[model samples]
Target: MLPNGKTNLIALDLGIHGDPIKALERIVQIAKSGVDDHVVARELIALSDGRAETRPVLGMFLGGAGLADSILYCRNQIYPLGLSNGLSHFLTAIAVLVSLLFGIRARFLPPSSNPVRISLIRDGELAGRFSVLIVTTLEKLLLGTRTGESQRGNMKLMAVDQSLSALLRLGWASLFRRMGKTKMQGIHLEQGDTIRIEGDHSSVILDGELFEASEGHPIVLRSTQPVPFLRLAA
Candidate 1:
C-alpha cells in the first residue's frame, strides 16, 4: 500500500504506462514541492523491483557522494545486487550515452515555420479563408492519372482558384502517396520560394514569381495563375 492508500498495482500500472522523465519534468515545470525529494523517492522505488534492483547501486556510484548525500543519508545504505551489478551498470551507462547522442542530433534538425496567410473573396465579396503549412520540399513528380499514383518521382503542386480545392488535392495525395504537399503563396515573398495559405481555408503553394511596387512598396500580382514566368518590376 502507498501513503495515499493506493495499491501497488496502481503504482505498477502508472510506472509502466507513464514516462518517468516526462513526469519529473512536469513536476519541475509546475514548481511543485519536493521535486528532488520526489525524484529520489521514485528512483528508490523503481530500483527496488525484483527485475531492477541493481539501479539503486548504479545511481549511487554514478551520482557520487554529493548526489547520494543529497538524496540519501549515507553511502553504506546503497547495496549492490550481487553479480547483477556489473551488467546493470554497463546497460545504464549505454542508455545514458545514447540519450545524450539523440539530444545532440535533435538540436541540428531543421525547424518548421508557420504557414503564410491569404484572404479569400468570392463574387466580389468576402468569403471564408483558410491556412496550410509545408511539410516537404517543392519538386516535380510524375504521377499516374488513372490511379492517382506516382509513376516516377514527379510530385508537383496543383493550381486551383479556391483554397478548398488545393486542400482536397493535398488530402488525396496524402491518402494515396503517403505524403502531403507544401502551400506556396502569400504576402512579402521571393521568387522560387514556397508559402502556405493561412486564413480560413488551409492550403499550400509555391512562388513562381513576385513583383513589388518600386515607388510605394505595394504588392502587385503579375498574374492570378501558377506558372513559371519572369516579371520585371516597374
Candidate 2:
C-alpha cells in the first residue's frame, strides 16, 4: 500500500448498484464553483437531503495511525433495518421501460420479509421478544421512519406482533411514500443495552459486511466502545 499520513474522507457515488457518474458530476460542479473543502460537505449532503438515493457510508475515524494510544472517535452508526430505499431511488437505478414493468410486478407480487425474534438483554435482565428491532446512528432514512436527533444512539424495538402481510405493507409504505404519514410499533433500548436475535436461517449486513445467520444459532449483539469516525463539520 502507498504510505499515508493525514485524514482524508472521500465519498464518491460511483458504483454498479447506482449511477456511477452522479457523484463525479457533482464533484466537477463543485470544482467549477471554486470553493474550499469547508463548503464541500454541505453541497454533497444536499444530494441526499430529503431524497431516497443514498450510499451506506461506514467507517471508524481513528486519528493518527492504528496505534493503541491514539484518541478514538466517540460515535457509532448502525442500521439493522432490511434493504430498500424510496421509490425515487429505485426509479433512478434502471431503464424507464423496465421500471414500469417492475412497478406493476411489485404491486401484484408484493415482497415478503421473514419474521425475526429479537430479545433485548439489558443490564443483566432479559426483556421479552420483539417483532421488530431497528438500530441506527447514521442514516436518516429507512423503513418509513426517521429517528430524531435524541434517538440516534438507542436501538428501537417493537413488541406488537404484526401479521406477515402487515409487515410487507409497512415495508412497501417506506418504498413508495417516505414523507407520507405511517406508523411504527416502536420503543428504544437504554444505553448499554445488548440484544440477541433468534429465528429461522437468514443473513445480516453489518458495516457493509455480510454474514450467514443460521437457524438454531442465535446472533448476539453488543455495542463496543465508540470508535473514531470522520464527520465533516457543518
Candidate 3:
C-alpha cells in the first residue's frame, strides 16, 4: 500500500489490459515520481518487496548532513556532529549512490532503444527521437504457439524520413494529436527486417519486426536481439 492509500492503482489498471509493457512503464514512471514523493516512495518499496528501501534511508541521512563540511572535517570530527556541517555533502552522496544504483540496474535491465532511431529509414533520413520501453509482456496463443503481445502490437505505427527534421515534425505532430497517430511511413521495413543501431557506447544490428502498426500514428517494433539504450529494454 502506498502512503496515500493508492495501492498500485495505476499498475492494477494497466494489468487489466493484460499488458506487461504498460504495467512496467507505469512502474518506472511511478518510481521516478516517487524519487521525491514520500507516499509514492513507500508504494514503490511495497511493490518492489522492499528492494527499493536502501537508498532512501541513505538519502535522508545525507540530506540531513552538509556535504562540504563532511569532507573537510573527516579528521577528528565527532561522528554524530558530522551531520551538522552543510547539506551539500548529503546531496552529493545521494547523487552518487543513486547514480550507482541506476547504473547497476541498467546493466541488469538494459535500457530501451530510441524509437525514432530504431525505426530508421534506409535513405539516410532521420525521424524524430522517441523512447520505447516494454513494461510487460502478454502471452497469447497465435496458431497454437504462445507468443508475447507487445505494446507496439497493441498500438499504431508511424514511419517518417530518416532525417532529424522529419522526425521532429512527426514527433511534434503526434504529440499534438495526443500521441494517437500510428502510421508506418517513409521506408517500409516489414517484420523480420535486419537493421543496425549506432549508439554512444555500443553498436549492434537488430532484427526488427513490426509488432504493432497503428493506422496513422507510430509503428512499434520488437527486436529479436535485445538493445538497451532507451527507457525500457524488455
lDDT of each: 0.24, 0.32, 0.27
Sort every candidate by lDDT, greatest first.
2, 3, 1
Name the candidate, 1 or 3, with the larger lDDT value: 3
In candidate 3 the C-alpha lDDT for residue 42 amounts to 10
Candidate 3 deviant stretches above 4 angstroms? 1-162, 176-189, 193-234
Tens digits of per-residue lDDT for model 1, 119-234:
11221211122122211112222131121332122222222222334444544654576333344332011121121222211222112111111222211111112222111110
What is the lDDT for 217 in model 3? Answer: 31
Q: After the best TM-score superposition of candidate 3, give how far the Cα of residue 9 lies from its true spot, in angstroms.
A: 18
lDDT of 2 at 159: 30
Q: For each candidate, what TM-score against the reference?
A: 0.18, 0.39, 0.20
Sequence-dependent TM-score of model 3: 0.20
RMSD of 1: 28.6
**Per-residue CA lDDT of candidate 3, range 24-140, in tens?**
565578667653332311111000112334321100000001111222222124324445423533443343344334543333222322333333234343333222111112221
Candidate that scores best on lDDT: 2
Model 3, C-alpha of 225: deviation from truth (Å): 13
Q: Which candidate is the best by TM-score?
A: 2
